[model samples]
Target: MDRVIYNFDSLSQRQSAATVPLRRSIYRARRVPEPRIGIIYNPRSHRNKGQDLACAGADNAMVAQPRTRDEIAHALAGFAREGIDFLIINGGDGTVRDVLTMGQAVFADRWPAIAVLPKGKTNALNVDLGAPADWSLEAALKAYASGRRILRRPLAVSRVDEDDPAMLGFIFGAGAFTLGIEAGQEAHSLGFFNSLAVGATGAWGVLQALFGTNGNKWRRGTQMDLRYLPGGAPLPRSKYGDPARRSVMLASTLERMPMGIQLFGAPRSGLKVAVLDRPRRRLLAALPAIFMGWRPRWLAEAGFHQLDADAVAIDVAEPVILDGEAFPAGRYRIEQGPELTFISV
Candidate 1:
């Protein structure tokens, strides 16, 4: 078996002599004609089970199925050190989250061009990136070679008070939204996936929020304080006169969402947020407009609010979910990270 080699001449020269080790790389003298490619495949992904990926297994292709977060970080570090040009994340949203969070420090601000294959239980990131469900590694590479690509910025989430490094991903949600994701995971275990799982989850969420009483976990919502960026102004109570409790809230830089549901209207660039205050009068009346991407003036007055923001600082009273993973209650800031190029083909 051929072993991968890394070149660290640039950084080793800057570090003290005692700390650096002797490293040899073919790249030291000659550059490869093709853009070096690295793939991080997750064998446990729902779609990858029992499948043979010969392209990924090729000797020239650098593929690593890291079993742990530390292994993932190590794999990304090696890819960066080897100067790979294209990174193909062949798994679900969780894999993408791990890459962005773990690879943030490895790549610094700049990231190599990336492509994703929607092979997970939930692939909202792939949909947002405009990659079709059938997109394959071969097609993505061909597209990159032909200059078919687009730019997107991952949401950088960081603890405001603690010194923990920021985590990068798309789709940050809280309150009932977090509970909905938990339901989605349940749907996954029932053999539902893709659009079916999303629809099933949505239907279940609606039932919980509708017939259930205020004491219901889904309807009671979570108490959270929000401070919009720049001026750090606090978000006011909903026009329905509801308190600081929010039924659901979602934030993202992605322009598209699963099932064509647009939480943040029109979906232009920058950070957009949609918050549904405690279900009030006309809550059912606003459902169509809310999911259809309509930004009617009456929507805000009815307790459904959408706003544009440069960044948002949130003090979450309960756990928050980003992509598909949950985090503890804390003061966190979620804003746009560096814009990255991605293969559209």
Candidate 2:
């Protein structure tokens, strides 16, 4: 039996049509074949508790709920071998990160279009992709079958050493950003999760960095050495303020961040970076304009540095936050990865 798959894009139009024959005529007029889909679901994700995975099963769709990283790798290998046209991830940020890292071997030089269901505590990537929290796997598969798509690139961070593995995700941060992650964890413990927790923790971090004295860890900042790649010139330390330390450092391939904040001055497509030196007198006032995407002429002179770079080397004194996971401190090379297609509408 050939199952009829409806195009999500035409759902509104089909529903408004007066008669069944008219809907049938529209369907026949615009019918397109469905693509083979593969779903990798993580049951342990925050919002995935007690969720139904059986609904994802279909004639052309394959759903695999993998419990371990090794299982995820194996599933991706099988999907690649089977030649799936689209891949849907049904979990949170950590699940997405793990899949991208483990599936790298199976998807070398070739990637199927991907879609994500926002099922996590903080779906930052999904928020940027404009996927709602209630987005379902069935709806996503339908979207893959016929709806519009948005292409995005992810940031790839790896240890400087060739032997070490690489991690793929949207956001990367250190210095005060690292401390903010710790505070965010505390906020989560107090029943403040999601976007509220993010904003609260961020506001607290900024306040601590402002009023706290020079010796405060969050204020004193971390020691890091940054060198631009392709040409190994050392990044200007004087531009930030203190040559030995920086208060905050962050990089992402995402244009819009959580809480609808525009962290970068301009909407850059690739890897974008923002760095701040130890607090200057005008640091408090400068933050508001920067958050609004304002490109004030004195931003750099006020010890705020933003740039778009092909690659950067970061040797840090502390652990950094990638997505929501904590990565060990080391010398890391950050670069942009290939463009990936994501479902929308």
- Per-candidate Cα lDDT values, in order, are 0.75, 0.75
**Candidate 1, superposed: residue stretches over 4 Å from native:** 1-33, 56-59
Q: How much is 280 displaced in model 2, in angstroms?
A: 3.1
Best by lDDT: 1
TM-score of each: 0.87, 0.86
| Shift of residue 303 alpha carbon in model 1, Å | 0.8
Q: Give residue 18's lDDT in candidate 1 (0 to 100).
A: 18
lDDT string, candidate 1, 1-345, tens digits: 001221122322222211223233321112235878889988877799899764832356688998766677778888878888888898888788777767766665546778888998879887877788988888777766664567778898888866566777898888988888888878888998987888898888888777888788988879888889858997655655347678888899888888888777876888888888876636755676678866677777778877888899998798888877777777889899876777775
Best by TM-score: 1
Cα displacement (Å) at residue 244, model 1 = 2.7
On residues 123-222, what C-alpha lDDT tens digit does candidate 2 reach at each position? 8888888877789877886776677677787888887865545677888898988788778778877877667877888888878777888888778878
In model 2, the runs with Cα more than 4 Å from the true position are: 1-32, 54-60, 239-241
